[model samples]
Target: MGCLSATRSKAIHKIDIPALDWPMARFPRYKYPLEDYVHENQQEDAKCLEETEDLIHKYNAAGKPVAAILVEPIQAEGGDNHASPEFFQGLQQIGKRTGAALLIDEVQTGGGPTGKMWCHEHFDLPEAPDIVTFSKKMLTGGYYFKEEFKPPQGYRIYNTWMGDPSKVIMLEEVIRVIQRDRLLENVNESGDILMKGLTTLQNQYPQHINSTRGRGTFIAFDGTNAAKRDSIVNKLKLQGIHSGGCGDKSVRLRPALIFQPHHANIFLNKLETVLSNL
Candidate 1:
């Protein structure tokens, strides 16, 4: 299938892969402290959306029409980049006009990591997406699509263990635990604490770090440079906190569903100590 992806700048997930000879549109890059640059960020959104539409038209003109458009609701590996709701709404309209399936890659943001079963639920699209691919926290890789997009015949797509009953059994228990413990609620509560703490740290250490952003516990903050970012991650590991890097210099936080406010506090304190030593 002819496919094209529009992702955020510095997207680590898309690096070093031989991609199809399809188009790549620019994703919006907003200014820090979003409230301070409202007009600028809005313009950024418009520019990116316009570019996306133009690429779809250009690809069609080249005799290789785009059958689908893939995107992440919050570009996780792209430093937790986020776009406004209006931006996603505009994209849906483009997909409708172009008759291209809107395929959302929710592998990184799905299964309650973003305080929602599916991150696109936060976007408020007019209708369900044409396709959604998931894995990672979901315990297995799969795609959900509208009935119209379903293949007419079976075996069109097959895998080694196509009908794995054991995976389903495990997923059932995972679902039960999530619902029984209200993990989504826990994610929200912990996310607030993490976001607030990061914001305060950003304010306090304006020179060392900035651009803290996320939805739920899927959060990140940028370091002053690549070396500083690596240093922070290493130091956090030494302090009994395992963190990772994304994008150019972003320190990402991927906490589990059971993570609570107390856990966030410990993380915040450890992060603060790391920054202080740097």
Candidate 2:
């Protein structure tokens, strides 16, 4: 699996658990306000892609062939980090050249958070990934795969229930609601307002926060420190606006797709109140 995060410098999750000695490559750390960081971010992309290729080669030469490479469109659990489309495109090419099946994990950023059905769709990959694992917003856990990845024989990927059929029924209703309410459009509209508010807040509180980033309504910002981050979350909750933190000092926004512009304003207003108190 390909692991990406700046917070690795802090600690690795579940290090006590036994894990395969797989090759881990660093993903890019792009400067925020992506448009302004184009040149630098491109360089960052090249660097990470090169490191990935080198690691794959090194492992293969040592007779530890990597069967697949796993990545997240937006490394959600790893601090809501993001990489560029060009970066993802290059990684796909490298995976193809190296004969490693490309797997995109959309556990958090899928189901319209990034203004698309799937975050990987934003990359404009030449073809679908070999595997696409999803859950969270999907209201279930499963994966889609290219036909070639299908098991040649039955029972290869079976489980007691495989997945709950009841969940499927619930998902059907969820899909209906998404379509009936045009939630994707709502996601886009609310995301615009939320991001603008975040940018303004970031500017106003530069000493306490920075690195405001995300697509659609999936947003996050880094606090000055871990304590400050936790305090912000706690304060927001006490004010009746719940939020979450990831990495060491990042607050993530995970509003539902149906969340409207007015709801975005309420969140921002709560955030402003919290910042003032902080």
Candidate 3:
């Protein structure tokens, strides 16, 4: 029901769909090296949080109560925008005080890519999210929630495209392999390598790329502008790595959980080669 309404981006202007009249709140933008800009980031988070609460209250007063607070742990499609864990904590409290369910869209940050089964786990929320939606790397699509959220009516949500049970069955085995092989550990190891190597690259090529950020292998860095970002993506593909671009002018990295130290080293070397010529 909310599919058409989910898109809340500047490019939403380009889409000619009849979206619902849901109130939209701004997602916070933070400076990279989150440590260096802690004060500014905290202020940004506070401003967004206040606006979100005001929107919720205004809509409620207008008799259109906010039901669920949906968010991505890291704004993957929104160019990998990230907020501090404290920001999430604030949102969760807002949800609790307002009886709004916290619905985390984990399609881009799930299945152990963030060194956890779900990215929200990093926030240490008081309780599990009211609902957790997942897809993509999980090999199927569905959402899970605490028992309290069970639908009040039967057949409230049903669809033929709920996805194949076989995919879920296969995914069960995939989970086993991930656990048996300790892939989360591998992700952490590779993530360290990526952060270290990317930091070095950022230092060396500040003009071409900057603000390298991400968790685990789900990383990204910005180019000077959209044109340079596209060129970087194209150059990376030419070098035999199928890289992708996201947001306005950012190159994103969404490597598999099985990516290892050697894989990180290879990506770094190839990326360095790309930056060197740029």
Number of the predicted model whose lDDT against the real structure is largest: 3
Q: State which candidate, 1 or 3, has the greater lDDT.
A: 3
Candidate 1 lDDT, tens digit per residue, 1-278? 12223444444656665557767777788888889989999999999999999999999999999988788998877777889988988888999999888998898998998899999999999999899988888788778899998789998978788756688789889999999999999999999999999999999988788988888899988998989899999999999999989888999999999999999999999999988888
Q: Any runs in candidate 3 off by more than 4 Å, and if so which?
A: 9-16, 158-163
Ranking by lDDT, best first? 3, 1, 2
Candidate lDDT scores, in order, read 0.88, 0.86, 0.88
TM-scores for the candidates: 0.93, 0.92, 0.94
> By TM-score, who's the top model here?
3
TM-score ranking from best candidate downward: 3, 1, 2
lDDT of 2 by residue, 1-278 (tens): 22422124334554554556776788788787788888998899999999999999999999999788888899886788899888888988999999999999888887888877899888888888889988887888888899999889999988888787888899889889889999989999999999999999988998778889988899999898999999999999999987899977899999888899999999999999999879
lDDT of 1 at 108: 93
Kindly report the root-mean-square deviation of model 3 from the true structure over all alpha carbons.
Answer: 1.9
Find the number of clashing residue pairs for candidate 2: 0
- Count of residue pairs whose backbone atoms collide, per candidate: 0, 0, 0
lDDT per residue (tens digit) for residues 35-70 in model 3: 899999999999999999999999989999999999
Model 1: weakest 10-residue lDDT segment is: 1-10
